[model samples]
Target: MPIEWIDCKPISLVWFSWREPLLYVLFTPWLLSLFAGLLITALTVVLSIRLSWLNRSLIVISAVLSVNIIYSPLATQWLSVWLSSQLPQTFERAEDAPRPVAVLLGRGAKIGRATSRKAAQLLNDHKVEAVYVSGDRLSTAQRVVKLGAPAERVAGDSCARTTWQNATRTNAWLQRNHPEAPVLLITDPWQLPRAAHAFAGQGLKVMPMAISPQLNSRTRNRLALRETAGTLLYRLQGRM
Candidate 1:
């Protein structure tokens, strides 16, 4: 039987997908901030022509402050630290529950490879009974298999495109097959907070395991900011 999903719909339309250019930029951190700042500046500049000096001054100040806050390295750093703090140190095992299955949430080829490696390691160590790749499923699953995870022990679906979808889809699968199995929710450190919350919201037992790729400071800050924005958006949508 096919499971019904709540708070998510399977992708049947291409234009509205999150991967579309507009939505992608809107969700991405640095790009969104830069675009917003430019838009605000342009609008205020045009509006200033009709306004009094004081009003123009106010708009300029507001624009500057908003841009500074969003672009601030300190803000991104602080948000990254706070997000990392929300992750669980270890999985809470239950005597009667089946051994945890690693549910690797894919980001991209780089991070997905890193996460697949971690999942393969867990399977080899017997820390997890099986591995399931969500998000970018096929490529990640192939990587996991190549990493030495037995082909029979790895499974996944390509239906998930977002963290919310990853959780809900995997939860539906778990409910139908391994109802009591704990999930080792694997992803990058910055994304772990929102990803874990999303999985837990769908009533899965989630234990976050971060396997971040090697990124420079600039790239890391961008990802951290993106995750921060994602967390807030999810909260507003009540998905977490």
Candidate 2:
């Protein structure tokens, strides 16, 4: 089952299906901010016109907010790049160290194609001995297999719905299976810090390998904003 909070259905369904533009409006940060800014600006204009005593300050505030909303995508991109630079792209395990497992966190019910490709590449490059995906195990395993990975080399944990669950459950699996192996935690750059924290908290040694998406400005901004919010939420819950 999907984690209630991480799953988009509750919010996306209210507007439209996951594939619809309305879902973007509801979940995408830049678009949602733009929509809100426009609405506020329109309201300010109507009030200013209707009341002679309406303060010019309100108009100025609306304009500034609108500009910020429009520019959010660029801001998010900058943040992601900065965060990516602060983390390592590759993990080097000592020759004597046990072979590490590549743990790829799923985006939702599906392990996205980009992540699947990255996992396959890691296996091919000999960066990891095996790949363990968290989220929808069956689907994630299927995706890896479709990407040409041997079925035996890929493992899955379907019960993990949140980052904490991902870490704890995977850690348990590792302990039972490959106790001394370090983990190559995989996810987007923006999500790496929290994921690393969660895994480390579970007493697992982690080496983060981020998959930075090549998204357009608007999409990047949306992802950044979503990641920002997720980070904050995790912090509040004392998970990161």
Candidate 3:
């Protein structure tokens, strides 16, 4: 029987969805840590006015611990993509990923976020003919990938409404460039189903390259709610 999926739906939708870094950049986990540090710094100032040196010393120690624990790891994660490669096996599809033209979809069209390292290895080995990043040509890196097409075929793109937008824009690009190429759409597991729907709807043959890590935290949880609401708002704005 198909599982009812009622309980799993919201959690899967939130935890697995790729949050494109478009709005409220501060709400990002790293920036929120900065906000936490500032909060503690303010607290330290308030306490220093009342406490003696010995007691104030305790405040300093506590402040550093709070910020380090709450924020340092996030900063490390936001910065060190290398460290992430050391963590336990997260997503498994890429382990034996087929050499379909990697329809690498994400907010960052890099060789890392969606396992560009692995993708690059595959491309170098003639596994994937090209690394097609689907999104607006937001940076020079994206454009550079395209200038060397066939050998690279970067194909930096844009005009996406959501994960769904990534599908539509990529299809148009594919039709213009490699229409016969099969797609190995890469995205967070949570988003793959939704994105797959849009791609299949567009009459494209696709295989999922689910490569995102599971996000578990209060902030990520809240972001899920925010995304759901934001999605509704976009629908209202006639943007979706």
Taken over the whole model, the C-alpha lDDT of each candidate is 0.76, 0.68, 0.52
lDDT of 1 by residue, 1-240 (tens): 211222334577573555467646744556766676677667877866777767766776676567557446787688789888766445578777789989887687788888888899989888888888776747678777787778877877877777887888788778876788889888899999898888888777888777878877666776776787778787798865
TM of each candidate vs. truth: 0.77, 0.69, 0.46
Model 1 score (lDDT):
0.76
Candidate 3 off by > 4 Å? 1-99, 108-112, 136-151, 213-216, 219-240
Clashing pairs for model 3 are 111-116, 135-157, 135-158, 136-157, 136-158, 145-154, 149-153
Clashes of each: 0, 0, 7
lDDT ranking, best first: 1, 2, 3
After the best TM-score superposition of candidate 3, give how far the Cα of residue 189 lies from its true spot, in angstroms: 1.3
Q: After superposition, which runs of candidate 2 have C-alpha atoms over 4 Å from their true positions?
A: 1-53, 56-60, 63-71, 85-92, 108-111
Whichever of 2 and 3 has more lDDT, that candidate is 2
- TM for candidate 3 is 0.46
Give the top-scoring candidate (TM-score): 1
Candidate 3, number of clashes: 7
